[model samples]
Target: MRFQEDSIDSAGFVLRKDEVLTVILGGGKGTRLLPLTEKRSKPAVSFGGKYRLIDIPISNSLNSGFEKIFVLTQFNSYSLNRHIHRTYSTNSIHQKSFVEIIAAEQTVSSVNWFEGTADAVRKVLPYIREQKPKYVLILSGDQLYNMDLSDFIQNHLADSETEISVASNSVPEDRIYGLGIVQTGENGFIQEFIEKPQDISQVENCRQQDGSFLANMGIYIFNTKTLVDVLEDLSMTDFGKEILPKAIREKKVKSYVYNGYWEDIGTIRAFYEANLMLTDDIPKFNLYLEKTPFYTRPRSLPPTKINHAIVNQALISEGTILNHCEVHKSVIGVRQFIDHGTKIYNSIVMGLDHYGYFDRRSGKIPNGIGPNCEIRNTIVDKDCAIGADVKLLNLKNYTEYEDEYIKIRDGIIVVPRHTTVPDGYSI
Candidate 1:
């Protein structure tokens, strides 16, 4: 449904603009997305050629008119913090609206770091309480979707009995193992919930009539009182693993089914596939939505200069210089300098952080994919220096391999951020 400027719900409830507080959970060590998360947090990890993973949820919240956001971050959050600070600025007149970052700190009550999702929010409860919100909208920092959160909130407000509302979507049986599955009765009242069940049969009873299972999208709306009560027990660390199931048994947790595009960028394969999918003729995650634009740190880079390049089905960002290159089915990020004779196919080149003027006479290799390089089925992270004649093709089809510079996970080569592959390097 389209988001309306008016805040009146169908149930005739006046949804206050300041009543819903947004809390985006920046993920933990991001172990599954390692190497990429080696230097930056999961949310800070770049995506869609120009935007970071964090931008998705933040943009959605802003578009939905819920601006009082607090991003809870812990592991490797410098880049994420910097990105948020630069991208989102609040109006001085509207002091109530802000996109603030709260990092994990050693408090007098607890000296340890955040254990899980619930723990992260629990530690920041004091700050959240200060917002004086009636309801709290929780989001994951590393997800991709354009949701009308105002509608999601309205659904929760529609039923006074709903203490918690979980945004869910149907997924095939094969995709249920890594997701939280929910069984719902009439009017989307959740009957049972299971988090990341190892055995498919564990959720056999939760399967829908169409053979798909209702999987939690990791988006939630909780009454302020309910959130505080559920998080009172410090032992309940994770929302999915510990808190959610317990709440499901006692509280009136409803499910709001989202039929739009949603993807959890949890692993290297998922990340690689999602970026490549953006190169599709009509991608599932549309970046061109006028009302719900994917917001990021706006750069004033010059338009991409394609010098006689044969490009097809690619999303090339601004300030990129493609010199006689053949880019097909790729997402080349901003400020990329692809030299002549390089061919990037089925890959994601997260371009340079900034343009560099290397003294060619100093025998220094610049920070970009040099000429005569062939990168296929790979992800070259930002600020990488790939020299000429380098071929990052997993020709041997190694499912898993790693070195100081590159890693092959699920048969896709990942050159970590700021890595430098010497001239004529091949893998």
Candidate 2:
């Protein structure tokens, strides 16, 4: 399972755009993210400062020169669909290169919605088979990481006998139970695959020599014929739970070890920590690399206006205006307006889309952080209206609590999209 460097030129192993078809699975309910996924799909949820979660994989594929991509969407996919349509267009690159979306639709062949990851791909096999891809690249939409897909494909091509190759990484011991565990032999071939083993000893047995266990990264490279054959014979709903384990028993599967930063933003605590990590002095994952930069829709927003505002160690997105505010260790999204005498600490203020639309049209309080509010350890989702003198401190340390305007998870207050906190309110 080792690639012979001399057999293949490392300098010229280029996976052509036409040779591969990338399928991005973006059809999750994202129940863990709750209010954020209430209106939009998980992949459509905003991430970092300005980009969506879907941008990571799409950008990685494009940067690796694989342009034929199909994003599979289901469950509250309006915003996700709109974002994809507005952002990605393949006509400029090549006539054959495109980023098309194949949503869950009712047809004569199948009337049910996608059940899981495997089912999602199974339902869209018709569109994928039509492309006639030599190797199919399957990716998850909610994970945040940068990878050169050509390298993964090149490794798979080097071992031409293997029908499947999976991308894996060494994960910390505490996170073993949350991910699928891969047991690889000495030759780098997958021997056993366990999906979320409850017993700690099962996870411990799979630990590598480096003290980290090999966790599945959810990135797979499959031979087109083998993929179709497996799908046709299996009635499994999920890949990790059923398809992968069965594939390991039958097909020749190999593991490509990735020693890089990868985060699966699947839960509220995970999302909160990942966002706050950007404010650190030296972040584990750097998003500002020029060689392989992250791509997103370019909003020609005005420069952030700061009028005597004291901010520290924060990621401030474009078009935000802060007046006489003290923001410490926070992230301010696009078009956010913080009025005078507001103090926000360890919080995320997702800005509004328009200015005074709610106040002018409906004569309600303006959409954004109003004057003299103090927010601490909170995540304010998009288009939120905070009336004057509102405080969201989470004093009770409620592990989980939900109300009309707020939902606290793991001590972080989450204000859902379009929610309004009336004047003089306190949480």
Candidate 3:
């Protein structure tokens, strides 16, 4: 169904949001995003300066009028839970709307943590079923994209025979691996499903007319009955690996092709690359659009103060003070303090939460980038204290390394949260 160009509200819609529930899978331990995910859950990881990775999915859902959401979290969810509680609050006007956290808990029937994507939903089946939703929208917490989810719902409702609607996007042939590939007939019904095929022939078979293969976006809209029955009948762990392929054969599943910018921020390299891409002259994924604005916790901080700093092609957030530094093509987060003579290029400096003083009463050096530091192609996580004359230039030709104060991946250094890089240290 072609989505209405006019107000989606006035458009001939077949369903209302009251009949649907949204579930955001926060995933298990994000091992690939190590040090960044060390202190917080993958969904809670900071992204685009001030927002968390999970905000992308939640914002999309909320903007689509699906306000009642349950964020399923597993590993290190304390920060995530706090962020949600602080950022989103339900008032008397929208009493029925809420953004709640559903942490993994041992029940009488099951006593294990979420084994996989499908298993996580399986364990929450009781809670979900109680709501009596006709359709369930499942989303990934760590993906970076903006989707009008009403289109997904309207597309599913347009075809009454479709029991499940899987969101798909065309990906280049070389990038088809590690993604659930879909083969669709001319009628738009998914004919076959493959789980990360290594063979080139299999990928070519799933190629669309646009010279790209159909890859699952990890976004699904399943009929409530179909989802419950499939979970009860199979002992599957993951949806992409097990359930999706089998469902294509037995159930009436269709692909809702999304021709928009979407990136799965799963690995460290993918995360770093996606963050840096936002520094472009005109980023593909725009966050400044008021019509589809990205939501986050609002802090009333003072305007950023720049003291003779040469910042070009950089995104400097609020409450940052740049003093005689040259930052090029970087993303400086909130409340950042960069001293004089610091030359940061192609990097991400995640600012601190509080101001740091040089007084001995504080007992610490200070937070943020110190003087005479030369940082390039790096990611400085939140609340880091970089002493003077520190060079974060990984001189070796290595892909990854783990050290006391830094972690390097894909030749990009990552200084984890609260890390203190002493003076005169050359990494």
Candidate 4:
């Protein structure tokens, strides 16, 4: 059942395993996600109620049998580091596995900070070089998907002549312009690469098969020697817009067309949409596998309860009590308390020392807060005392919502986590 080391051949092809290391890019500030990212880094954000965005790559590494992982982070790294320590600890006394968090400062350099993805790698080149891993696997921290990188690395090694291997996907014409588009030959040898081009229609038609173009999935594997050379050769370090492209010239740069469930949760809308995917009748991804498990520090609480509530397609964490409430297509974090007559639809509620809910109905309390209110199509931030029967929304029924705090985007109310609003006030 172990996918580790030498037992990783589902397709006979295997990768260079002697010195393999996985590095997760976890330092970026997700500005597009605004209010949510304002508090914490993208990788540290809560995902699927119980997991953080860092779990995707880390889980894949663990399941694929690559435990030597180093997450490179900068902003709000404390939370990410804490989570990793709590979940994938390398205490030496208990487990032999190691999944540690490394940052830009981990290197002995006067370099202010990791400038880009490439620069980040450059700063941490000492860490990788110290391990002397035969190959390097670079990954993103804010993506949502389940992948088997063992297959990817094995494929790369089988094509041993290949210098760099990148995972790509088939993106829509409109979405193509947002990603790095590549022209791969029938032999899977990538020819031309474009970054955020203006005209995607022509590019879409230029493709040979089914109007599909290969867009970068932000996943790359590089030979150790090749990586070192590129990191030293390139003045401005960045993988996406720089290193990989330069390495492809005269070098054996290959492409792996990935046809799996993958999503870039870099924005609030994308983050919200990915959670709703769990609502499907038969979900595209499942995290309930015993063999390829996604490990997390368990809350050690009992199962959640439902009493007179319509709970559909939601991932409710341990010790949650839903009494006469309606939570559909949402992610409720650990130990959350859903009071009676509350309706939380298409939202994310994170509950670990987070703020309580509030009602801004109408009072002199900064933002008139209320208690025990009816919530509908509204995202209430954590940690506020809401009064009974107070309404903080102005939708469908209520017309005059206070637009200063929560702006209505596409008819969805986004309540940033952990902001207090006084009771009895309606927004």
Candidate 5:
């Protein structure tokens, strides 16, 4: 399904598809999400089960009638580039709608990669100028949320005085520690901005009537001229830390409050929890919403086959074979093979890229969990081979631990991609 190319805003103004250009920031290094980002970029990391992190923002933009999207990527972008090309490339019929990948290049003028988020966009101003979009909507590629950006664009257009509009969400004081906080005065116009405040008292006045502070969602709608003017200073790299604070002080910046489920899948723990949350009866971020469905690369695989598996509160994707295993509150990704007697609880098993029948015959520790294995509070990345009787329970409850095969961060065990756990192995 496609959104209309033209629509009327709330203030009775025609909104054209070319008016806005969407830029999704494929994050840098992604050190926090280690192993997962080891081989692929942050945006290319698998999420929920079948979809990549980049799919979220691109899906939202397409659903919101803004299709001229540019994904800025730098480190480990091969998989990201391929995924975008395979999934988002439109047919020739939709000439104006395109999802282009703009990788950081070393030109004669500059011999460096993207310094930061702001710098990444600044470097791609030449490509953006070609589109001649009136507004530029910047979004994070690693966030999980379902937002109607049409409303966000409409809100920004409703107020002619506003040059930049930031999407803000009301979060508790304790949750605002590592998030950008904004203080808004009359008519929801932002008065001050602080990035990742160490002290809560620094923005005490920004607290709302409900006692929640407005935290930046890292979603922004900027006027093209305003964006160009602010990025003139090359030293200002990050939007949250530098560009936003300066914009608030000088320009008419307003906060568009977003009351929805949003999660930053930046760390291993956060990624694990966010995947588990989807197993809930009524998940905050609904993937089943028919109107705003999450888009991904479609696969032509057989339906999942479960042979008397006792599944409860789990989200198991297609092409999986569960043989008499008990799955409780877990998210099983695509093409998984769990043998009989295995019990998985509070875990995320990122299934294989392809069937391992040939690999199984070769006897090189076939992908997927073997029989009698016990997995609890763990995350198994793609193409892993867990042998029989292997236990990844993290029984000692260590805050942090690492070895050649596995890592425990924030008490959750993580078996990195392409790892093999031998028989009877225990953690």
Candidate 6:
């Protein structure tokens, strides 16, 4: 709903003021999105053509009028840190209001890295306590969605006694093994919380009145004092296995049913499918929707252009130059340069790093000596170069590669960093 700070009047327990603080869990390795996450953390992976995945939550928080924001990072957070600071901000709200990075910094006790998700919070509990906010909103940075968090906050206000509010969604049984399952009582309070149920039958039993099962969204809203008290009481520090489940057993956790477009873009197949899905005119998650726009660092570049090309169902980023090529059902990241007669179908062309090896190998980008080169079902990571008349086709139907140049994950060929498959070679 894009709830701005100045737009709303006072609603004490309703949390209409700027007293709410947001802590984004952006530290995960994103091991699922391999090759792409080969260097940077998960949050920095480019998404929706123009924005990174972290932009979804940051933009969501900005739209919900929560100015006090802190993004927690772990390994390789420099890129993630730079991207967060550059994109989506909370301005005119002052020091605490702006979007900032919060890694596992030094402490009097120790400078140990964040042990777990909840432990990450425990280490920063002192700083968070200093702010003395009534509520601290926590979110995992990897999920893809556009939600009105104000609604979730209002739901929390309606049940102030609940110590924790977890965002839950309906999921199929095959997917429940990786998520926390919950059962609600007649009073709409949570009765039982299962951390990734062991048995398939037990997982199916956690159903709503309409026979739908509720699964955790990895998004939490915590009461400040309750959170502080809990951190002080426990040595364990993971939200799924420790905090929320423990809180649920104490009868202090409530489920906030989230009926929105939410997808866990953590795996290679999921990431690939998600990006390609955006090629649709009416994608499930449309960034152009003015009611709730996802924010990112505004790149002051010219619009995308396709010359002498046959492009289909692809999201082309700004400053991209395509000529005499075929880009079908894929995403091309910013500032991509395409030469004449290069066929890129059902593949992603990201940053320039992928082309660095080729740039270094050949004196020039090997002038296209011929045409009819078909590169399909692969990820040519940033800065990669393909020689003229090179062919990198999906061999699932033909035959897998005999050599180690291409990596096969879930049957998709991935050309690694600074790699060259040689010109006109077929697998």
Which tens-of-lDDT digit does each residue in 1-427 have in candidate 1?
A: 4444448777787777788899999988999998899989999999999999999999898889888899999999999999998988642325577999999999999999999999999999999998899999999999989899988988888888999999998899999989999999988899899999999889999988899999999999999999999999988999999998999889999999999989999999999999998988899999998878888998889999999999999999999999898999999999999988999899999998888954345678888888899999999999998888999998899999999879998888999888989889999
lDDT of 3 by residue, 83-106 (tens): 988887642225567788999999
Q: How close is every model to the real structure, measured as TM-score?
A: 0.97, 0.94, 0.95, 0.87, 0.97, 0.90
List pairs with backbone clashes in candidate 1: none
Provide the clashing-pair count of each candidate structure: 0, 0, 0, 30, 0, 11
Candidate 3 residue 26 C-alpha distance from true site, Å: 0.8
Q: Which stretches of candidate 4 lie over 4 Å from their true place?
A: 7-18, 91-96, 106-108, 205-208, 354-387, 390-411
lDDT of 1: 0.91
**Model 1 misplaced regions, further than 4 Å:** 1-6, 90-95, 358-361
Regions more than 4 Å wrong, model 5: 1-3, 91-93, 358-363
lDDT score, candidate 4: 0.70
Candidate with more favorable, higher lDDT: 1 or 2: 1
Q: Give me the overall lDDT of model 5.
A: 0.90
Tens digits of per-residue lDDT for model 4, 1-427: 3344454444565443446789999957777766667667888887776788888889888778777788998886777788888887843422345787887573344547877888888788888888878889999988877888877876676665788898988876667767888888777777877767788554664464676778889998988888888888547667777776676775787888888888887666677677666666667767676766666665677688778888987888776667788777777777566667767666666654532332334443221123256555554444433444556455464322335455444344555654544445455
Model 3 scores a TM of 0.95
Looking at model 4, residue 266 earns an lDDT score of 64
Tens-digit lDDT string for candidate 6 (1-427) = 4455433323454344466789999856777677667788888877766788888898888778787788899877887888876664435544447787888777788678888888898888877877778889998888888888887877776764778888989876678787888887765577777888888777565866666678888888888888877777557778888777678777477788888778888677777778777888789877778877788888778777778888888878887777777778888877676666777777766644222222425445531212456777766665555555677776555333335566656556666655555566665
CA lDDT of each prediction against the hidden true structure: 0.91, 0.86, 0.86, 0.70, 0.90, 0.73
